[model samples]
Target: MKQLPLVYHKKILVLGLAKSGTAAAEILHELGAFVTVNDSKPFEQNENAQYLLSKGMTVICGSHPENLLDEGFSLIVKNPGIPYKNPVIAEAIKRGIPVWTEVELAYRISDAPMIGITGSNGKTTTTTLIFEMLEVGRKQPLIAGNIGTAASAVASKATEENTIVTELSSFQLMGTVELKPKVAVLMNLYEAHLDYHTDFKEYTDAKFNVTKKQDASDWFIYNGEQKNVTDYASKSKARKVPFYVSGKMKEGISADDLYVYWNGEKLFERSIIALRGKHNLENVLAATAAALIFDCSIENIKEVLSTFHGVKHRTQFVREWKNRKFYNDSKATNALATKSALEGFSEQVILIAGGVDRGHSFDELIPHLQNVKALIHYGETTKRLQEFGEKQSIPSVVSVNTLKEAIEEAVKISKEGDIVLLSPACASWDQYESFEIRGDEFIEQVLDLNE
Candidate 1:
């Protein structure tokens, strides 16, 4: 491997000085580009800006004004969180300065071919699955994107032979028009991030962008289970390869409990292990599709996936307290996910639920709550779900302001074989740092009982 000369020359404006944004700023600065770090957070609040200023780079805090756009700049590297809704970005577009996401900047820097994976759900599971599959097949891949590491961060350390298995969010893909991956997996598109996009169509369009730049030489693998994804993918110009868990894939892969059959041929399958439900099955299939496209041995993929227990936050089984089993699905941040998590618990469940609602209608999960023994509510949307529970006499309890209180109340009412589940179908911003933090705290509280 050779250290290539930095290609960026002109001044670059890096916006939204968050983790990904600041990383982009430093990377661009390292490339010898005159970097101007911009963010909406005030100077006192933005530790990144102060840190950059200490490092001798020009920093702009509080807002991205029109004057900054008017300033001669070669490129605008916008953070994933900064959407089209931002007035400053709107002004930038009006000024005709090219606006790019941190991910696009990441792709531009990397010489390695990529494995771009995006969907409404199952992204983290599938992303790690692909990375593991490639690893088992002897490819040292850089697993990155919204799974935590910025794409730019991944690119900073990438090599030619090393592949990138990216778990890209719609926000990351919104500005990506030319990121061509060798194998692109559009896992499954559904009603998500309606709070961010103008409509479902806009959101779906953003997820679909992963395949928009792919050529005929590249392959587009997707779940045929999602009608919207299947329909739009059929109309897409990319070389389509659709996979499914329920039925056969005309050009891609199909799955049974034993093996993932490709075009009616035996590709790969593993012995059934302790994977919980249907959602996980779907995740394995999506990963297998990408692995097959990348030339991974079918047997190696199945062997790894079979051994892979589950991700940290997605339906992670904590421990049994007093013969009562607890399932932590703090990653269930939408209505669809909550519905899926509740599918396995056929008996009465003491559900510890609610958080800041991510524009989800409770109606989608209402039918699935038939067996819920008690509904313990907390966070911003607690009352909304509690009121719904009252209409059906589901024995709802409201906690004063935190998830801990909700769990304490649910535990009191819970019986043996009665699942006490923390599948908050909303974001944790109102209560904790993120869903992962919320999940960790939930596990901590459960474990604290022993102490």
Candidate 2:
């Protein structure tokens, strides 16, 4: 890890002690910073805060204290989930104290070259693909950021020979200042997380932070088909490399029915790609561009792309049984995600959907329901989604109390040449703790059918 002289002996506040915050606080303290860790959880109940206290750092718990900033901190390393509207963050901003997330700290200490990936969607899939490709190429790659692992933890262990493939969120990007990657990817941006950012422009601006500090020597791989992404790429100082799904781009990665191309040169056959959906095609194009720029061989890229089914819970292909295919898309926690998943299939889809009721209408999904042969609705949104499916005149519409029952119904109705998909159009919180758990249930039960 690089020595960060800027943090040495400086008084820094590490706010909201989750995994990111704990890692940041420990790293800062190790770097000779006077680190004060804070969290809303009470001292007795907060294990992270307790652990930090054991390490000889000052720990604040239970509340923000209202006067916490009055102690005079040099900087605040905030948790990405914490909004700027928080009193402590707002005060720090007003005082010009420079608030940042742990990703900034990761950038400062890492010896490895980073490849940052960000977008409204596809970040995880793209990040995983790049990491796998680099691995196949024998390039040492470490995955981190929003894809489960903490960036600061990964960055600390990364060597000069390693490449850190990070999945960045707009929240994490918002706190970054000088965190420029060697190859930065900005996939298609859409309207999302307005509640956290407060507006569309701010959300867009936050996503652009991935390429904000890049120089001419760096590479910016973006979506050429997205006008917003292309317009933002124009502002980047990095060498722009855009990927197009429609196969119309003059340069960079574009594809036709036959092959995937890089700068109009054939790299691999399109049929080799195992992952479904045009959305995934965009991800593949962007990931390929980044991997190629990092010097990965075409052979290695093709090897990974051909075999990689998908990231789990996000349109992951489970298995084929009785000539029926199954996909676990439990991460489709909204209508848009389900729509994208539905579009990937040409075969009759026995779609199992419904989850936590956010009270939003599923009317937006009307146009995409044409291919759905059966709709097994479950969870809190069952009635709403059942109504939607019945209104759409889907051949078979069934409502169930649980996901297990829904899967059973799908199995009964599914026939040869059918695709049974679990693309719930709402969040999983109503029945499961997270989408991962919900997805795991689906995979286990679906696999049981083969037995």
Candidate 3:
């Protein structure tokens, strides 16, 4: 196990006892730091804090004490979900105390080389595929960050012989200052998360932070087709590796109707891979560029791509019902993602969409809805989408009260050779806690039909 450097006996405050917070506290404690953990939940209710308390660390629960900042703490590690508007965090910043996400701390302590992936969409799918590709060569890569496992937890067990494949988000990257991955991938960029960020520029800059600390020796894999992505790549110090959809690039990966080419060399045929859509193909190209640069064999990469279905909740094909194919794309929490999901199917679709209103215009999705046989919308954005669907002359448009109702309506109207898709164009927070819960519910409902 590797101990974090420059942390011995330093007073550290870990705010919010989430998974990342718990891991950060443990790592700090292991490094001989005087760690104090604080959470909004009551002490008895906070299971993570209870375990940390049992480990002899100080625990404060139910409230965040503003005066904790004056206790001569050298640093504060904050959970990324906690907004900077939190009084304690703002106070800490005012005091000039360093505030970091657990990712930054993980980078500081990790002995392993890292491959960081970030973008608007395709992060989980690309990250998972890259980890599988690296594992093909017995590389023992640890997957972390937005993909589920906390990077701080992974870093504790990482060694120089291993590699960490991380799926970073704009939320995670915004707090990072010196996190330089050996291979950084910026998949396509889109206007997203304006609800959390100040505006589009802040969101774009946050995603680009994945490359901020890289040098000339590092590789930056990006979408050559996206001008926003290419614009960001030009400013990065890493060796630029571009991936394209229509034509070949001079220095990276590209795909045509048949094969995926890496630096103009044939890598894998498009037909063999299991994942669908041009978006997923872009994800494969990005991963291929990263894997090839890491010395992974083309055969190993091809093996994974051939059998890899896809990650859950992102255009995942569920069971067919009455010859109508069902897809769970609950992770399509933005307009661009839903647009991508719609492009995969050739037949007219019975689309289930609409969720929390992020104030984004669904105008981009209108063109993609041209082949829709029916539009079933639910949650906060239902009325807006239902109205838009009707205006766009989609054959059928219905507004439902819940996700289950939306699915039931779609199932009722879906015909043979039509696609039933759950590709919500907004966040799930208005109805469900997260996209995973929403997707699980859709799967459970669809599975019940089999009975």
Candidate 4:
């Protein structure tokens, strides 16, 4: 399916006119697919759908009309964020029309082989690291997928010389049926997105789909530290390559605190990795494993590992204010991620957390709060988290109504040598539209302190 201008003249329905959906619609139309775009937002309000309407393409805005599904469409390209429980999607499945995310369509048309990375956490860091390593090796890697850009956007211009290094989410991978990469990395898995997935097993299976369609020639790089990750990788037909933080691996990547050993030879000092947090070491190992499978030079891996600090919103260092260091980890939308953020800081921290409750307990976050000097809670989970912090004997646990208030309170309580960390352990739906927006607000507030 590497044929140029694929999906030509085939009737297709594009659901959800967000980034991925809009990009998919434009490219599908460009590829000559008889495209009809749909989104839940009204045409007047949805700039994306409105833009598509002006492109001489058929668009149904305001709602996903059921009648549009029966327009002799051969395929349905859906937005990854749109849940499987969506009525139109469920109906499309019932009618035996194939459903795919833009990633699948992009995969079918991409001229370059792909290196797909997916896990519960650290995917962005690992994917960015691999992209840098590939770039150093002159692989002409195009980064896409769940990170930001749609895969098809990169695929539309790719050639056989390029390699697409994509960050796949369970949301993206679950819809993929034929997407296969030359190198697939499963960093690790944790219970996440239970709000979207039906259950833990379903989420696990969705992430494991990265290697489901690979053949023996392809490589499956997995976290040797996680039995679950290894267990799922075992089901893949691809050759298994395990990366670990403990013990030596004769064929894959392994690391201790000090050094990273790749295939029994010392690769680089783990300390050279600019990214903090022990969990990030696992990401380093995963990226190193994938780079090695892609045949990247060892020097390139070392160089990238030494220089790449981290991705934005994942332990991103904002700015030091009044001798106190501040970190923005607004991407920490779950207990595990917040725990990882706290693990990165050795200094006593003024922690700001809370948001929409995902019906999970804050018990998983208690152990990581030993270094927290103060806790500022806000949004829906404020009371519960403040209570939890009080019960845990935290020195200061204050509840606020908004994130801005939480940030201001954190600034007042923090002192020199203390770190201000915004590691919200819940979703951002209560106040902001996305984690990126929440993180931006945190940064904006922190930047405002200079005045």
Which parts of model 4 have CA positions greater than 4 angstroms off? 4-6, 321-323, 357-359, 399-416, 448-451
Candidate 3 off by > 4 Å: 357-359, 380-382, 399-402, 429-431
lDDT ranking of the models: 2, 3, 4, 1
Query: In candidate 1, what are the lDDT values of residues 166-234, reduced to their tens digit?
Result: 999999898885788888888887777878899999999988888887778888888887889887787
Q: What is candidate 2's CA lDDT for residue 57?
A: 99
Please list the C-alpha lDDT of all candidates, in the order they appear: 0.81, 0.93, 0.89, 0.87
lDDT of candidate 4 vs native?
0.87
Clashes of 3: 0
Ranking by TM-score: 2, 3, 4, 1
In order, what is each prediction's RMSD in angstroms? 3.2, 1.2, 2.2, 2.6
Error of 4 at 255 (Å): 1.3
Q: Over the stretch 1-451, how does candidate 4's per-residue lDDT look in tens digits?
A: 3543546888889988778898889888888888898888888888998788889889888877768777988888999999999999988899899999989988888989999999988899999999999999898999999888989888889999999999999999999988899999998888878999999999999998899999999999888778888788778999888887776667788877677887888877777787778788888888888888778988888899888877888898888888998888999988888888888788999999999987877788778878888999999898789789999999999999988898889888988899999999898999999999999998899989953
| Cα-based TM-score, every candidate | 0.87, 0.98, 0.93, 0.90
Kindly list the per-residue Cα lDDT of model 2 for residues 1-451, writing each as its tens digit. Answer: 8889988999999999889999999999999999999899999999999999999999999999889998889999999999999999998999999999999999989999999999999999999999999999989999999998889999999999999999999999999999999999998889999889989999999999999999999999999888998899999999999898887456999988778988888888899999999899999999999889989998898899889999999999999999999999999998889888988899999999988999977777788878889999999998888788888999899999999999999989988999999999899999999999999999999999954
Give the per-residue lDDT digits (tens) of candidate 3, residues 1-451: 6666567999999999789999999999999999999999998788999999999999999998768787888999999888777899889888998889999999988999999999988899999999999999678889999888999999889999999999999888988978999999999787777777888999899999999889998989998888999899999999999999886655688989888887788777888887888899999988888888888998898899888877899999888888888899999988888999988877989999989997888888877777888989988998789788988999999998998998889878977888899999899999899999999999899988963
Determine which window of 10 residues in candidate 4 has minimal summed lDDT: 1-10
Separately for all candidates shown, the number of backbone clashes (residues 3 or more apart, or on different chains) is 0, 0, 0, 0
* Structure candidate 3, residue pairs in collision: none
RMSD of 1: 3.2
